[model samples]
Target: MKRVEGRVALVTGAAQGIGLAVAQRLKEEGAIVVMSDLNAAALQEAARRLDADAIVQDVASEQGWIDTMRSIREAHGALHILVNNAGIEGDPSAPKDPQGAPLTDWNKIFTVNSAGVFLACKHAITLMSESGGGSIVNVSSIASLVPTPFLTAYGAAKASVQHLTQSVALHCATSGYRIRCNSVHPGQARTPMLEALFERMARQAGASVEQFTAAFVAQIPMGSLQEPEDVANLVLFLASDEARYITGQAIACDGGYVLAH
Candidate 1:
């Protein structure tokens, strides 16, 4: 059976990795998918691959969210699912820098990672609330739960996201919005983003990618990194009616990374 058939869904940062996987999965389940990302080339490529709508948007920009929702309202009439997946690590090399994190880095990271989700929720909630409500899944990270001094800014920002998820969920539930808000915390997933991350971490540690990956994988009790589909499946489940009773919770897609560590 189709889980979310005929639903109009929107996914941000859908050009690749987890966002792309969620978009693809939703479409496969018969939802009309709309994807947004700042990268024109990658977004275009992924849109073609999924035969889904593409909107170039900067999630941190309030105006961008406004315009995006306006366009969605015009094109799709209503939005049934919203995946706030647009986020950035913004130079994970802070551990190598003796000066620590700069103010600009902190602002940029939180703006896109934390405030972006807030902005999306602010606008999308109105749309969903007026149209019988829907589900919202924020793509957070296990770093939020695990203490990562190397990823100090990212961890802090995502922790804020986790708290924000609970607040949004509770508000919507109490206000009778019928909207479900949740955060999905992914572990080290196998994606281009993971490759870039390992490359940076290896450079910082003065080790090869193979050595770095081996050490990282050994840390996870599951013995491997998570795949994009692994994260996508959980997201799809949460978005579908099967999870109608679940909200205001942070679910992990990590392959036991947070549990082991």
Candidate 2:
């Protein structure tokens, strides 16, 4: 039997990159996938290509979470898997350190990255408990594990996600909801977001993008950047029955980058 056949799964930020990869993997595993993204145009096209459902959603809005849950309840009546992959890295051009980054950037990053995951977990747990429980895989970052002097706000927000994920997991486990929540920490993924960050950082350092990328890869013990599908594979495992015993943990899919870093 397919791992998640007949299961209803929702992936946020599914327009591209890791989100898109996770959506595709779930669909391939026989899940009934619902893809959501703030970018309506890209989401529609991606959903069309995957023959999946799409919801244009802003993850940072409380009303958006309410509407999203309502839509899921109406459409599927059950949500077996939720991938909270929506997040922002803040303005790359701005200073990102604690001493230099603006309060506005910090607020915006936390609103979306931290608070967004919290809201998603809040609403999802309710429906999931009502619909027979589910799994939540929050896409955090390696930034949460280590210091991020150049991306302070983003790191702090992701650390919030990590903590909240554990709290939610424990809450459901104790409440007999059967819901599992965990966070996945990815490192230096080769996504459009990372590419943009690399370009900006390279320019800031007056170095070629290739040189910057090479320096990054050199830090990774595996000597390469991870692809979106790499992280998606781990998510698939967690979302499936195979990881039924696993909960309240933060796993990294960084090709050993976290280890060396």
Candidate 3:
């Protein structure tokens, strides 16, 4: 049998990028994937391609989470995997440093990047426990593990996600729940979000995106941008039975970017 055969998985931010890749990977491993995203059009297209279920969701809202969980329970009866991949990088035009970043921007970033994960974990844990256990894979960022002086809000928010994952893992483990929670830190992946950032920075520097991308890749030890599939592969492992013994860990799939930096 395929890994995770017959399991039900919910992958957020499934419209594109890493989220889409993860959903695809899970389906390939024999999972019944339910994808969710704020972009209904893109999500529906992706879902139709995979022939998987899709839901419109805004991870930052409490009501959204409740409705989503209710829908999942009603449709699937149980959720075996919850991948919290929805997040934002904050406004590139806004001051990214702590001293200059607007409070509104900071709050906005936290609401989606960190608080969203927290809310997802909170709801997923209760349902997973009732369903006899499950796995949660939170998408963090390598910026959280290092000093992200240029993107303070994004880095800090992802750091909170990492910390929250650990807390949820320990709580479930000690409570005798079979649930597992872990965070995946990706470094310099070529995603829509990252590409947008690069474009903005490139314009500011009067240079092409390729020039900016190459300069950025030079900083990574692997000398290449991490592909969404690379991170999705690691997420697939974490969401599978093979990682039953692993929980509350922050695993980096950064192409050695974290080590060299």
* lDDT on C-alpha atoms for all candidate structures: 0.91, 0.94, 0.92
Q: Score residue 42 of candidate 3 by CA lDDT.
A: 98
Q: How well is each residue in 1-261 modelled by candidate 3, as lDDT tens digits?
A: 578898999999999999999999999999999999999999999999999999999999999999999998999899999999999988777988879999999999999999999999888887888888989999999989999877899999999999999999999999998999999999988799999989988887799999998888898887788889999999999999999999999999998888987
Query: What lDDT score goes with residue 212 in model 1?
Result: 99
Using TM-score as the measure, the top candidate is 2
Instruction: Count residue pairs with overlapping backbones in model 1.
Output: 0
Candidate 3 whole-model C-alpha lDDT, 0 to 1: 0.92
TM-scores of the candidates are 0.97, 0.99, 0.98
Error of 1 at 45 (Å): 1.1
Candidate 1 lDDT by residue in tens digits, 75-129: 9899989999888888664542324778788888899999999999999999988
For model 1, what is the alpha-carbon lDDT of residue 55? 98
Candidate 3 Cα outliers beyond 4 Å, as residue runs: none
Q: After superposition, how far is residue 244 of candidate 3 from its true place, in Å?
A: 0.6
Candidate 2, which segments miss by more than 4 Å at Cα? none
